[model samples]
Target: MASVSVSFPKYMSHIPTRHAGHLAELCIVPRNLSLMKQGSVRELRIVRSSNQTEPLIDCTNKPSDIPLLSCSEATERLKQNREKHKGKQQFLAMYSSIYGGTVTDAAAMAIPMDDHMVHRGHGVFDTAATMNGYLYELEQHFDRIIRSASMAKIVLPFDRETIRRILLQTVSASKCIKGSLRYWISAGPGDFQLSPSGCNQPALYAIVIEDQSLFDSKGIKVVTSSIPIKPPQFATTKSVNYPPNVLSKMEAEEKGAYAAIWLDEDGFVAEGPNMNVAFVTKEKELLMPNFDKILSGCTAKRFLTLAEGLMTAGKLHGIRVDNVSVEEGKRADEMMLIGSGILVRPVVQ
Candidate 1:
């Protein structure tokens, strides 16, 4: 276990950046989201909440991740996206303002991003989602974030409760209706050294947003990746070392695909550069890598849970829940992309 520290970044210079013209696009559109598994190209759509019949809002002042609406309108917004528009949907990034500016009781300040991440990509973070407004299984994401902090030796200033509260509150305060949420924490700022202690200006935030509309209906289209996912030592760390995955996803996009799935040095199905891979058999079963090379996913674990439930329910004998050969994966009746954002994304290779 690693002890966490709280404070400023080591090398946060006063270098400024041109105001991002796509700030709105950056927050709402998945146009430039982190890498995700296969999907066709399509225009993204936004669904605003409908608080009509009953109000879902809580008069109480406590902050929430998914905003409470009047029970009526909440019911309406949560109803469903009217089916009409059609296009190939691709990106999935939607981060909300956890604090300050808008969309929350307590808006957050515009804290500066560190040069280390901007220049060297030397930061760490974690992502998780909310189920019915609650951050589904938070302990796992929190543990992973702590692990990321430990690996990079970046200390966090707040206690687990503080962080947990912020995450939950952010989710509960949102009016996302139904969808996913993404959260991250940085080592702040630091020097150019590989060590993490130099990160002085740490920032923590949680955002609530919906996923691409098409994914809910038709499955995603993916390609076997040319680039492979790295092992835990280099690839496992959840640092802002995102350029590699970002570039790979970009490459995939250029080819009209969704993500770059990585093969380990041993040449096995490791995982997508971002999400975990689950190979479901024709017999109604699923499998994920057990080498710990891939990020242990919440839904991945649920796949195992579902399998066991099915077994208990006599759905099947059992599922081969561990990693298997890429040949085996290719033969899977169906492949799934599992993660906080995707929930369970079907993959059509």
Candidate 2:
């Protein structure tokens, strides 16, 4: 581990930033944030987080061996790389507030490297599902993203109505009827700094990703995550700070599970990495954990409303949102995960 002396406030010290010759390293700064004078500096060390001692790359290439390219040369290389790595899901269109337009070419759809969201994780995002030329629960998702942006302290790049229109136009331009529309609001491109104050302005980015596969109702295995859950303040916000989520998912995958489930500080069922968890109890109640400690999932909320019809049809006894214990959840007759991306997926184990 490498250490650096920082002169700024100590609160900003824990943020791990990229440094030379390593994936991540910790630098200490001040905690109580205040306006700093010139040369008030923070020290950073680019250190590896993992235990692996070997370098990621062999010592075969050097700075002198690299070839510098012009703008057009870089664009051509990006296009070639994109074409060579095409996958099942297609990126149809993207809207960037930075450029004030939509781009159909995947090579052209890129966010600035210095965007606070890119390096500092100062952003919030949400997604809408498109089906048969219509956006499902677009209003609700849009509202949630706005709330998330507010919670993340990222100002909207444009008014709500204008943003909505831009989203609609991006999806329309894509002509993708059976996919999802994802968008982000970031602190915008600026110098790489922990504070968003240096950002020139906020930015909005939207992309349409086309998925042609039919929905599968298959149940999947899940495991309790060893990774700790985030605090309620951060957990409830759909921000781009997803390192915990990513690690939890990786843990589940390592255990041959679909997704890892997190428990609250009190050991009550919280949620999956990216989706809401729901259970159908033996008594036929649609049971879900309260949203005060987890993300207020739009798809999960909509499903709760739709499930009301099932109660009317005598399929469910009632619906309840409360603290669900692990034993209680495990004993439930049916378990499922709900989210915009996965919709409703049954969990078998």
Candidate 3:
């Protein structure tokens, strides 16, 4: 392979280059550099250059070198990157057992890369909504996470009361009156191996995200997902392994739908990608699929308990939790998806 001649300014000459084929490309390894394309050539601009200048070079190969960064430099770069994209949801606070405290800076809100949760997906998570400065059904959600961690064979980092207190304190620090709190329990940072035996300890992490959006009452459309449903054991646990769920959600959005519903191996209605399904029959009876093969959503269970009042008020004839066939669900008078995040969302299609 012939060497591709490329010239940079005196200050930028340190950047290494490489060659592939007739098609030329420039590969910059630093995250702080900005790429600008003009006509057929691309230019690299140093974001924090002392002279505040960009390099105009005719590049034909990718760079084999990567810049080694110090801990503070990397953290600053991450903070800069986050400043570029400000979304509607704001991360107000974070709590990490690894740090043994809480951090209000969004840049400091991160988990270790070696964590089993980040690598082998050996983690479980739960979410609670903050309503009017209070965590709604936090105890129920906390109980579910505990069950999930036990099923995943992850020991808690702290006792139940301790963890609960940490969660509340983290939320209070955020001062977010209305938002959501999400937390995770992982096997902690360890070697890149299949077994969690190398993990010295378990980890817990929590973050509070502020959402100003109101509860949307508009009904949405849904379709049957082509992705296979998770097995009963894994399905029931709210673990971090969610490739199937992610794919199902993407499949629905690709077809212009809000969400995709799943069916069990026996063809009974299972649940949505992340929510439970419930229906109101023509006889004014409330019906839902059994939780034997799917996750029992905290919000769905709470709704079922509260629905008894509707029965007493003559709004519902009865409530049943059994196998709901697809045909039966389709024939129902109304259908809704239930979960902590959504609370309850009606499905019009």
Summarize candidate 1's per-residue lDDT along 1-349 as a digit string, tens digits: 1111222233422323342323332223333452222432222222233322222222333445687688667445533332233233311232222233224322221334443544566556676654454556678777877888778665665678977776666666565445555666665555666555576555565566554443363477666677546557767677777666777788788888777677777777787768888776767665677747766666677667767877788765557757568898888787877765566778885
Which candidate comes out best when scored by lDDT?
Answer: 3
Write model 2 residue lDDT over 224-261, tens digit each, in one string. 99999999999999999999999999999999999999
Q: In candidate 2, where is summed lDDT lowest over 10 consecutive residues?
A: 20-29
Q: What would the per-residue lDDT of candidate 3 be over residues 89-157, giving only the tens digit for each residue? A: 999999999999999989899998999999999999999999899999999999999999999999999
Number of the predicted model whose TM-score against the real structure is largest: 2
Tell me the deviation in Å of residue 306 in model 1: 2.0
Error of 2 at 33 (Å): 34
The alpha-carbon deviation from the true structure for residue 322 of candidate 1, after best TM-score superposition, in angstroms, is 3.2
Alpha carbon lDDT at 127, candidate 1: 63
